[model samples]
Target: MGRRLIVGTTIDRVDDKSLTENSAAANRTSLWGGRFAGGPSEALARLSVSVQFDWRLAPYDIAGSRAHARVLAGAGLLDPEELGRILAALDDLEAACASGTFRPTVDDEDVHTALERGLLERLGSLGGKLRAGRSRNDQVATDLRLYLRDHARGVAARLVELAEALVEQAGRHVDTAAPGMTHLQHAQPVTFGHWLLAHVQPLLRDLERLRDWDHRTAVSPLGAGALAGSGLPLDPGAVSKELGFRTSFANSMDAVADRDFVAEFLFVTAMIGVHLSRLGEEVVLWTSQEFGWVELDDAFATGSSIMPQKKNADIAELARGKSGRLVGGLVAVLTMLKGLPMTYDRDMQEDKEPAFDAVDTLELLLPALAGMISTMTVRVDRLVAAAPVGFSLATEVADWLVRKGVPFRDAHEITGKLVALCAARDCALDEVSDADLATVSEHLDPSVRDVLSVRSALAARITPGSTGPGPVADQLATAADQLTTWRNWTAESVVPR
Candidate 1:
């Protein structure tokens, strides 16, 4: 009894699976083909997250198996009847798992073992032969690659949607003047559209990265079994084709162990998170009473418990906080991969949690960001009012002086003296009397002050990509065309219905 108890405790199944299944199969001695001499230590299995987390890949695993079965039959490894049984069992197993009719055993260490056991239960001993040339090493890698491929496409699509929203809002606000910042200090005048475009450009690069990574993840890593190529006359290309993989992995060890794709995806996600965090920070500042340039919707904001008047940008704040976690996820994967051997290690098991977390985090964040942006109201009057609060039009005054035959350096110095004179009089350049402006320098003419207003200053900058109304409108139109092209591409390259 004591020995039985010892063996039973060491080979426990995943709890998340066992709750729905019966106790008999859940108490099985081994999850694998009983290859090892004895059962795993009970304490070890209890502490394992393998079965619990890996089961999420069951659908992909079943799909890969069906593809492999077809390739095996093509290579004359399995007879037609055997192939039919395997394929049929795979389909049935998929439906069972999807509909919650399948139950995993406690002894099933990971998704691979649980799935094979299901096949064996359904097809009798014939299911056992399916593992003849396959190993979990290649199987898990293939499943993860397929899963990430799908997710990469999804993430890119969402990015396009968010980018389109930004462009639309920017187009509406193209003529609205605002202050541009340097070191968080008001430096010059810029249209609000230009600010929005700055963010759209970064996301566009991020989307491109996802698109490229999607192709890199398109290959199948199956048939590279157990740190080396399988001994059988297995055709990996056939498996790749059947499983929708663009190509087969080149080296067996690298194929089984390579997690650079995950790392790359995570890196892209981290950069995206950083972008989101920056946006969140801006929204937080803009909505505060101190700034008051924009007002967040009540739906996107929260009220404080103690302060009845408080409306906090909670969603944006959460997005900001989640960026730390996304960074942590990238660091975690790097730590796991830092000193590993050539082939797959148990350390590789730590890979999915980070990838899954990053993907899930972005999925939640992108839509929230789009919502906040779409619903929030930008106070154009407030933005414009703040535009020239701190001598923002000083550059325009200098340029006006330069146009009137003053050397640029001399014009810049004259503008500085004029600013100091206005400061002494406790007034703006526009507020200073013509005689008062002349007190600082003889160069300050009534005509120079005439072009110093914000609108006049902005209209003078008609260069391409400038914040002048005409240039801003042109930029918005160009951004609109790019958004249309992006939308069409996202619709085209996505998975088929």
Candidate 2:
């Protein structure tokens, strides 16, 4: 019979008057009540999301249904025979759908109906009581929460990869000296590894936010039918456990209406996007001809159509552009919830698109950025060459005078005079010989010239969190250990397909 049907691939089914109905059997109050009496106008059904979009929640819906079936069996609502038939039918329906043998038609309207209809067809009407305690309001909300929890981990895992990539880069460049900036002007000499590790710290906070959001979305809303608790004696806690939720929602109204999870997830994504945008801005700046502190691999860069010499940092530019979209996603969720009431509303349909977009954008962006960082070359010689051009070692010379019994104010004045003399001569501080130094201050002895050297200035910073080699090497070891722990945890949690 199956082979015969496969030849032409047509199967007979019953007519569906339910599709034209303004609401499903679960809700009698029509969305457009005054306009219609019997069924919806054809124009309205075409615009509804129930038939098109809600079907995507089928897997989550079926999983919830299986748990609900067990709840119903435990509550004494179903006899053993009826419970067996319902369980068998639901399992058969899931398998058929999973194997691509089931085709849900347009008339079924949503996953809820498609599932019920599939069950009835398989078990010859014994599957009718399975949905008695539920409504699509709570069902979809539960499904969406489950879906978000699963994918939030995925987003978190990708973020860990990006963080690890940054740590790896930082470890490799632990001793590489680079110019650190404030207000886009050279401020001091810092290790390139320190700068890379700085980016990792903010991203680690982003990872924590993601992991926390996963726990927040781990609650179930299955037994909250419409705006009130279901009349049936349902075991919501049991259902929550079976479906991998951490808790049952406390209030039925809140369970059906709350979209805080979506908002929070988008907020986390937006903040992370802000961090990525900052990284992108730095990469774009460093890769420029004027800075030339870092060189991007050609694969991650692009050339202008007209200018042959133009190798634009297009990957970073795209990352920067996508951050606006992430910000927009957060704004959209907040806008959707601004005036929503205490229960479920059509306005909540705006939730999934933003959540999905934020996740999708980050998944593409994080891995691409990791790849870019892994391949990009650092111009250490260029950075070191640029470091001294801005008199970056001036502070060390001032400090040396302070240690020689000159008050800090006097030392600062002395260093200022010496710097002024060097500027007037158009020579570097180190280039000013001991004879020229003694002319500025008697404290500017032969030893003062040693403090002017960049290497000496860097080595003088032996304090914790300084740009000196010892503290930088300590930071590298700490960062590597943290990254290793995160990688091992992530590797163990690989959810199988």
Candidate 3:
């Protein structure tokens, strides 16, 4: 029940006779080991075990089995009695699995092996007939697609929740100006709302990617055998319809080997992690003592164990850090697929852990990041004061000169000289004297001071996608509409149970 350190180095040393006996014992119970002389030895068994991670797929696996049973009955491979008995056994096994009443043993090499073992326990020799028209290659592929399609909706729903936080916060600060940056230096004034909405844009794209990925993933691979399809009269379309797939496999070999759906899911989740990481970076910086622009609630933050004065943005930090893990998962799966020739290879077994890790990582990370965004407080006074700091409104001065018939290149040079003079005098762009402004450039008039304030600067740029207040308002409305569309999407996607 607790941690224990092992201080021994004795490994299992099996002689040839004992190895043969162990392998022979494994052959009878093992799936697809009958043709071989014996099954895996100790080294192979240790390397071959996959039931541990793959057992989470039991529910989807069971659903696939139910569909397969109906197809088997239709194909006359199983009588009505056998089909009824198989379905009942699967139901019992599924319930047992869900309740922790049954589970994979160490001897079971994979989820398919474990489930077959369970079925054999239930129906004796009749359980063996269930494997007649299917292969683990098709089963695993179908199970993974079903599992991901269900979880994708779940992940997208959480994303919409995060977007809700962003839109809600954006709505409140629609007119509250803050210093926006380029290259981490003050570049212009923008509403805090616009910054929040920027995070949502990427997430909306992620959600859209999930929907698109689902469309490509909706085909069923249940009847695809190891390489080619079966000689039996199994109706893949019937299996597909029962399992809620849009269609069945077009090519059995490709169906058996396809991990494209898993790869696309990894890419989508990795992009989500990147989007969350960017937002996390901003939260860490903005909530720091120097920025003082935002504050996190105690519920969403953490305190250090030894350092009494430390309140840590561990949630944000973890979200930021997990981006690498997500990206690594994508790269790992891609690399695994790069060298595989065709059809089911043992190398493809390496794909599940990384893809599963991506789903688990985002499943845990998204809600916490959303809560952090929702509960954080914006320091309005600090934001407004900092909005025009470092002459962020200097762009307005340049544009003001351009409006007065000054060429942009000449206007740019004049603004640069004025900025240099202000720096030399240790003052702001507007703090330099009117005479100093004229001395800086005759293009400057006292009326050029009109656009110096952050509010004036924000109001001047009223383009649809700009950071100006009216544009920000329009985009906010657009964001709200997008969230509504997302909610409707999650509701309508019909994720499999």
For model 1 the local lDDT of residue 341 reads 91
The regions of model 3 sitting more than 4 angstroms off are 1-28, 492-497
lDDT of 3 by residue, 281-326 (tens): 9999998999999989999999988999887888999989999999
Q: Judging by TM-score, tell me the better candidate of 1 and 3.
A: 3
* Winner by TM-score: 3
lDDT of each: 0.79, 0.76, 0.83
For 1-497, candidate 2 gives per-residue lDDT tens digits of: 00001011111122243233333454332222476567765676555545444444566677788788889888888888888888777778766766557655655555676777778777764677787788888888887786666666667777788888887888778778888788988777888888998898888788778768877888888899898988888989998887777789899999999999989999999999999999999999989898898888888888989999998888788889999999999999999899998999988877877887787798789888988887888998998888777777788888888788889999989889988998999998878987888899888887777777667767877898777888888877776677677655444321111
In model 1, what are the clashing residue pairs, if there are any?
Answer: 9-42, 10-41, 10-42, 13-106
Better structure of 2 and 3 per TM-score: 3
C-alpha RMSD of each candidate structure in angstroms: 6.7, 6.6, 6.8
* Number of backbone collisions per candidate: 4, 0, 0
What's each prediction's TM-score? 0.90, 0.85, 0.93
Q: Where does candidate 3 clash, by residue pair?
A: none
Model 1, runs deviating above 4 Å: 1-22, 25-35, 103-105, 404-407, 488-497
Work out candidate 1's RMSD over C-alphas: 6.7
- What lDDT is obtained when candidate 1 is compared to the true structure? 0.79
